[model samples]
Target: MKQFWIVGLGLLPLVAGCSLFETNPVPPSPALTGVSAQDAAWKDQIKRVRGAEEARFEPLVEAREAVSAALAQQGVNDYDAASLEEAQQALDAAESGWAEVANKRRPNGDKLAAIATDAHRATRLAEIARYAAVREINLEKLVAVNDQLETREQSQPTRQARPVTGDARDLVGQKVVPDQLGEVSFQPGTARMKPASQEIVRQLAGLLERYPSVGVAVFGHTDNVGPSAASLERFVKANPKLEQQAPSQAEKVRAFNLALSAARARTVAQLLVDNGVPARRIGARGFGDTRPVASNDTQAGRQANRRIEAVIVPGPDSPEAQRARAENAGS
Candidate 1:
């Protein structure tokens, strides 16, 4: 049997087995223009990093990830600790200026601008360092390696790629417009779906079962009533009969609105799985009131906001895809 393993990241391979790991070159961060990496800021950072013509691709991409991690608090910034440290200094200055404002003093805008410029330069230098480290420091080795590459390129021209059949559209993954199960909703202050919502997802779950390659994403939302933690607390207090069967601790609610949103999303995801959708293909998240479709002050508007929306994320067939596939296979 072909296995589809899901790791902690919630992303898995669209296909299984050795069709993955085919001799593909890791061309760089253009590797993910996919749904998950669609943020404008992320694309801008990637473009700036990949613009280094003189540097090898791997080192530049690796360095970009290092800066990203340090800023995001995910891991250590071993690529350029000093630049990362300097960037942090800018943040410290901004924080200090804000503190002065609390004391009735003028806030410093210069420090904030400096932070932006400093971060940009740091990221650029991180990419440039890859080329400088090899070419400027080890001139003899660089020249020797260049000579070998030039000779090879001259003697053997690049081969033409094999042509694929059908239209170009057929080769890429399809992204369908998300069907939002119109008027679907949850009971007030709880994750329990009304009957209409259940019927809609049941049909969607069947469609997902029919299309194994299509991926489903569930985003939970709230009506801006309050934070998710507080909302969840209120729900627990009011609905003691249902609290016993509630989902496990999220550990990181921070606020109640988000907590309620998450609970609703998990509820929807579970319902879909029970209906027929494969668990591995479903990814869930809570948007709270951040992405409200209507104003929260009105009852109708609040009702609209308190709903779940699902999208079918298209799979990207790239080096990253292959790596994800490899990781899934291993898992």
Candidate 2:
């Protein structure tokens, strides 16, 4: 017993030293860390959808409640079934995905992103189901009443193959408003579209085609990883290739970053045009490293900064950007 105690006592300092040397050995799951902003946004969107509805359907309402509870760290957990009857199952899936990440079993990012999308869709379904379920009478009478209306609706002119000129306002409104839009990005120091970005651009092209009046503006930015001026002489030396001695390295770096951003924006704009969106309805710009929505110190943050910010522009008549649109209509 004394020998055992002595051995254990001797190992205590070793264990303590090992722990002291370990620094951030196990970081937080990238999936959960990256999606904090997206989760908050989805929560708000879900609330708005529920608020806008005339009434709430039972299944959808239950699902919404379950999702709310799940997100609150209640209801279903990693250990339970944790199923929501409706769209927010994706939310639970997202949580479970993080657990999987912690165990080093799976990558949760793609799955969570997909689920976040479904949760958004679920909100719409919840809203639509509520209105469709309401009846002035019992189920039998309601079914009889809707049968004829359903047939009439079938015969009505479909919105499919709608020409770009079709009621511009309605067309604009009909465009698929993606859940959490405008988060597309590219590879480091390259204008090449990440695979997901290509798909998003494709979707945006279809949107512009459907709504000719709805203009799109894209801006590109860069992570702050290049030359910075702390002193005047060093600044001039940084841009060694420039013949003009007065031009600081910071100025040269800014110009390079801006150009890189512009190239990316132009690439996206050209893709939109090629995909059938009119060139006159899209504008692309680059702000370089001047604007950053996230820190540039981490990989995720840097990727977020190195992005193309695509905005849905208001109508030509809207007070916002009316002059800018007129002057720079995708030129």
* Candidate 1 lDDT by residue in tens digits, 1-331: 0011122112323211111111122223333355434333232332323454322222233444544545653122433345456645544443443344323322233432333344444454433332222212222222233235335535766733222223322322211212333545777767788887788778667656555555555667787775366655665566565566564444223245676787887787788778866565555566677666678789999877777766443223433345665774696
What's the lDDT of the predicted structure labeled candidate 1? 0.47
Clashing pairs in 1: 227-256, 227-257, 228-256, 228-257, 228-258, 229-255, 229-256, 229-257, 230-256
Q: Write out the backbone clash pairs for model 2.
A: none
Number of colliding residue pairs in each model = 9, 0
What lDDT would candidate 2 get against the real structure? 0.48
Q: Write down the worst ten-residue block by lDDT for model 1.
A: 1-10
Candidate 2 residue lDDT tens string, 1-331: 2232222222111111111112222222223344666454333323223454332223234446544543443222331232324435443543443344333222344543554444444444333233222111112232232234335545778734333344444333222322234456666656777888778889888766665445655667898765334433453455566536555566666766886787788788788767877554555666789877578889899777777765444433333334443443454
Deviation in Å, model 1, residue 5 alpha carbon: 24
Candidate 2 residue 317 C-alpha distance from true site, Å: 8.3
User: Largest lDDT belongs to which candidate?
Assistant: 2
Name the lDDT value of residue 317 in candidate 1: 40
